[model samples]
Target chain A: MKLALVLPLLVPLLTAVACILAGASRVAQRALSVLGSGALLAAGLWLLRSVDAGGIQVVQLGNWPAPFGITLVADLFSAIMVAITGFVALCVAVFALANIDPARERFGFHPLYQLLLLGVCGAFLTGDLFNLFVWFEVMLMSSFVLLALGGERPQIEAAVKYLTLNFIASGLFLTALGILYGQFGTLNMADLAVKLRDQPSGVTLSSAMLLFVSFGIKAGVFPLFFWLPASYHTPPVAVSAIFAGLLTKVGVYALIRVFTLIFTADPATTHTLIVVVSVLTMITGVLGAAAQYEIRRVLSFHIISQIGYMTLGLGLFTTAAIAASIFYIVHHIVVKTNLFLIGGAIGHVRGTGELKQLGGLYRDYPWIGLLFLIPAMSLGGIPPLSGFFAKFALVKSALEIPSYWPVVAALAVGLLTLFSMTKIWAEAFWKAEPEGATGGTRGPVPLLMLVPIVAMALLTVAIGFFPGTLLDLATRAAGQLMNPNGYIEAVLGRTP
Target chain B: MPLQLAFSIVLLVRGHNEPGGGFIGGLVAACGIALHGIAFGIPAARRLLRVPPPMLIGTGLLIAALSGLPGLFQGQPFLTGLWGGSVPTLLAGQLKFGTPLLFDVGVYLVVAGIAVHLIFTMAEDQ
Candidate 1:
């Protein structure tokens, strides 16, 4: 059972080592990387099923008990997130085989990719705050190298900005951790939850604010998200796709976890700040997307807006709202990743991502057009898609809670989200290929590349169609979150 | 260079309970390699390493990961300390050699691999 508990994280880490061991054999590395991701997927699904069936699962590394040694605890939310992380890893590995160039592959892309997944799984599973910070550092360092892997001028430039901003966030995060640890004498989240509720302090609020700034930058929230749009467009499609799908969400996860678990002392203050920031984030993100001309840039801005939706539920802080948020995140991850892959596929065929330079994709490649439409319409919250239910659940919860301002922002952002998706649809797919442009069919997009996009798109459609079970899962996850007694008991035992 | 290599080896061995551990010892070892690369030139140093520096990373990682597996076999959690029954040591007093020490050795190799590879790449670039 403990072996099953750690497999989701252990598998990726071992795969990272295996990838490095393959050493200069790109073919060997590719095969190993794919196998690793497939293993990760199987482990993830197994953990999800087991956790879903059996409540929270806890395993202490090196056999040290909680609050003293690091614990890996997977509750409903964590198991779900890990399962999705593995799914994305599998899809991206397949895509990278076709999407990444040989030069990049030889530069140890496979190892770095596996390492990134390892860091992500580690972050999701670890129950210690300090361990979470360590995982953040692991993920950040690998991403920095991956971003600058090819050493291209633009990538190098973006890497500098990305690293610099994230370093500031990291520094702030570390400072907050130091402060919390100094005051509370514990870093185990459950222990902190038990401790902080009994002794509230001014330092806790300040420390929480510091944490917000750190996670805010990483989450790409308004006023701290400039680095996202600036650098996200500069990476390779595979890099951008994963970064778009997973990285910012880690910050959001941290925010949701800490707020729900430890910072309940003054939800009145922290939750209000969250609600205000979320509204601002929604407005600015959609507006930002509306302004971008490049396909990836538009998608990048929408990621910010989508993040706002996820956080809004946190701000609302109701069980239904949080469940809606969880559902929204699940829907958004698949949709956003598929959309980025679509952008990549178009770039594959047209040699550019500029909307002006791209056109008649619908005319030339109907498959790409259809693929784009599913996620695009889903993103816009069209009926009978995952995004619609996600948005509907959130809207209903917000209206019920009467968090009126965020509710308006959510609906307006949905409209603007649709506007930008159509902007992409009309410019990239609908309009005739401008004469003497990059739109002439270079060739069919590689089968390996197209397969992942289709898989994710079909996943979106499947979730939309059969959301009863998944939504029920989300509701249970939200229940576990709103009442974190199960999480606490799992970590600290019943009496403690 | 030989003295530095010997000193680093001592540090690596002495690292389990003492101040010097895998990271610092690895850096010390890399310093020795850097000195040799400077004196004898890089190509000769590269020839001496035999295996490429990057490959050392894989080897070191596998070693470190493998060190953690014995615990699982013994029905403990991953990475539990499984010390071999007490062994007496000169100067260091009682040194218990086991998986923890093996883990440190793995870390030593990994750090040395990374540091040397970085230095060599920069040196060769010039």
Candidate 2:
């Protein structure tokens, strides 16, 4: 079991090293990335099965006993996250193979991509708080390069803003960790959870708020999310897809982990703040999405708005609410990445990601348009799709809490989401081709790229129809989180 | 160029135990790289480094992230430092060695890499 946890982290690191040594060899880089990602995907699936048969599994490092050593715990929730990350990474790699310029093969893109995967996997699997921050830095540093890869004016401008914002966030994370260490004298998350349980007074609450603000900035909640939209669309499409799919969600996952396990006692104060901010996040994000005329920019804003839904679930703080949030997160990652990949393909066929310049794509690329529609509708929460089920579950949970404002906000956000989706559809795919369009020739949409998008679309539909499996997985995960004594006990041995 | 080197040295010396560390130090070093570009040429610097600036940034990040792995097994949070004997290797045993040293090294590489890359790219544009 420990092997399962370590394998995902090690494979990427090893493959990255291998890619570097292989140097300028496209075949070597591709083979190494595929094999590495494939093995991780297999390991993630096997871990999922293991969890379904039993319960959460903990992997304590270096034969160290729990509480003192760093631990990797994979419940159903983490397994799902790992699997999703592996799948998305695999697709991004394939897309890069087809789309990345061969001349630029030696530029270290492949190595960084693999390293980024290691960071993402590590973040999902680790059962400690400080380790989580390290992984966040790992992910951020790689993303900084990817963002500035081409170093165009726009990319540079975007990267500077991105770097500055995240630097501040990392600084906040370090300060929070310092406070947590000072208060509890430990940084192992499981141990912190134990120490937090018996803290004399309001220390836990204040520390928890500090942790929340730190993670919230990464998660892109309303106030701190400005960096996301300002920079996300400036990167190349493949880079955008990976960032769109994985980065912010890692923050959200961290929030869910901490709030449920380490800080479950105070809902009225913490959860209400989450709820209020979530509503504002949703409204502002979708409105931002609606206001965008550029295709990628619209998608970027929607990322923030959809994150609001996921946070809403955590804020509602129920078994059902979390399950729905998990479901929505998975659904969003697939749909959002696919939409970006489609946007990439559109950018390839046409010259720009601006919707005004990207008309009549459906006529030239009917298959691409059809593929785009599935994720778009799913994103809009249309029925009989994964998005619908996720939203339905969350909205139902909100109503159950009988929380009128959140329920209304969730419903309204869904409508705005649909409006934004249609806006992209109308301008990019439906509108007439502009006159004097050169209709420049482009290579056919690469199969490697197409396969991942189609696979994701199929998964979206399949999950919607047979949501029972994912739903059960999410429920068990939420359960493990709610009663995280098992997590703490597994990481650190029982007292006395 | 001499002044830039002096700045880099100043940054590296003040980095430890201060707000400035390898990251800031490396950025300062990059300012030196930029000076080299101004004094010489973009192609000359590129030939000297043998990789683009972005790749350097990528490699720096990799090193920095990898620096945290030891903490995972030490029962410390990721990136948490481990220290052993502080006996000096030189200077009459006045100096100490620690994991923070390794972290500083990682920071050094990252800072230097990013600095060089930024200078190279900016020079290319010019």
Candidate 3:
């Protein structure tokens, strides 16, 4: 169990090192990259099983006890998260084999990719507040490099905006950490959960707001999502797919984890704030998506809108709501990533992502259209697909809370989401090629890229068809999240 | 530059107990190497190191990650510091050999490699 706790982190760190050392041959680096992510996936699965069999697993670094030494904990939520990350990383790594330009690959893409994975897994596994910050920086640094890897004019421009906003967020996060430590004198999350309960509400609310704003920026919630759409489309498709799939979700995860564990003192205030932000986030994201003409930009806006649904679950603060949020997250990660990959494939064949420049994919490559349809419909909440169940649960939870506005906004956003998905379908797939457009003589989408897209699409169908298993797992994770005693007990060895 | 390198080694050895640690030691050593490169040019400094910066970084990371495995093998938590008998050193009094020192050495190499790499890139770009 102890070993399992660290495996997710260790595997990636070692893989990244190996990738760096394998610099002499691009083929070797690619093979190592695939093997490493596969190993991370295996380790993630092992950790999930152990955490499932024997509840939350905790490990103390350097043999120091809890609240003093760094801690790594794997609950069902974190385990599932790590497992899904490995799944996505493996998929993207494979896709990059064919999709990434040789110039980019030669310039250290594999090692940076592994380093990004290392940072992500670290963020999900670390139990210390300050440790989480360090992991976020690691994740950010690699992602920033990945974004600006080729240093094109547009990429450099986007990266600058990304860096400036993220640095501000990081500053706020550090300030919150300083304030929390000043009040509670502990950087351990479990310890803070215990200590924060007795302190006056002033520091608690202030730090909570600070954390919300900081994580909100990361999650791309309302009024702070400008950077996402501006930057996500500038990078290579593989980079965009991973970013769309993982980066903002980490922000949502942090919001859920911190709010559920550390700031339950005044949910009436904090959660209410979350509720407001989520509703606005939903409305704005859908509106933003509706206005986009580019396939990736449209998808990027939807990421923000969907973030609203997950945070809504957090704001409702119920087992059912949180479970729905978890289900939504799991479903969204796969479906969204698959959509991005499909978008990349579309761009690959057509040579442009602009909807006006694209058309008749359904005629030329019927399979690509079929591939795009599954995830696109899934994103739009079409029935029997994963999105429908996820949205249904979230909406049901909201109705039960008797919060009518978020439900109204979610349903309305659902409609808008469907509209934009169809817009892409209509403009990019249904319409005949524009006059004088050079649509001829391009090769079929590479099998390497098609393989991951198909795999993720099938996974989406599987989840849609068999919601019970994932929903049950999500319920258990939510139960663990709602009751902090288990986490506190596991980490501190005493129930708070 | 050679004296500075020796001083960096001293700092690294004394770091486990005192204020001087791998990070500071690495910076000092990198500064010395940067000075050499600045004065004598890139080729001479490359000869002086005898290995590329990226390789140094990879080696350092591998060493650091490997250092943590002993604890896991021993049935303790990962990264648990396990110590061996003290080593009698000339400059620093009896230095205890442990995974921490090995980990520090790894950090030292990585930090130094990164600093020198950045300096080299900046110099080359001009």
Query: Which candidate tops lDDT?
Result: 3
lDDT of 2 by residue, A1-496 (tens): 4455666776787678667757667888888877877777787777777766766777765446665776778877888898888888888777877667664566777888888888888899888888888899899999899888877899999999999988888887788888888887888887777777745358677777877887888889988899998898887788889999999999899989888877866788889899888889999999999889988889989999999999999999998999899988999998999899888888877768887777887787889888998999999989898999899999898899888888888889899899988888888889998887664356577787788888888988898899888887787788877777777766666741
What TM-score does model 3 achieve against the real structure?
A: 0.98
True interface contacts reproduced by each model, as a fraction? 0.79, 0.00, 0.92
What's the lDDT for residue B88 in model 3?
A: 85
Q: In angstroms, how far off is B107's CA in candidate 3? A: 0.8
Ranking by TM-score: 3, 1, 2
Which parts of model 1 are misplaced by more than 4 Å? A438-441
Candidate DockQ scores, in order:
0.80, 0.08, 0.91
lDDT of 2 at A279: 88
Alpha-carbon RMSD, each predicted model? 1.4, 6.0, 1.2
Task: Give the whole-model CA lDDT for all candidates, comma-separated.
Answer: 0.90, 0.80, 0.92
Q: What is the lDDT of residue B3 in candidate 1?
A: 89
Clashing residue pairs in all predictions, respectively, total 0, 6, 0
Model 3 stretches astray by more than 4 angstroms: A198-200, A439-441
Over 4 Å off in model 2, which ranges?
Answer: A198-200, A439-443, B1-126
Return the lDDT, model 2, position A189. Answer: 80
Residues A112-135, candidate 1, lDDT per residue (tens digit)?
999999888899999999999999
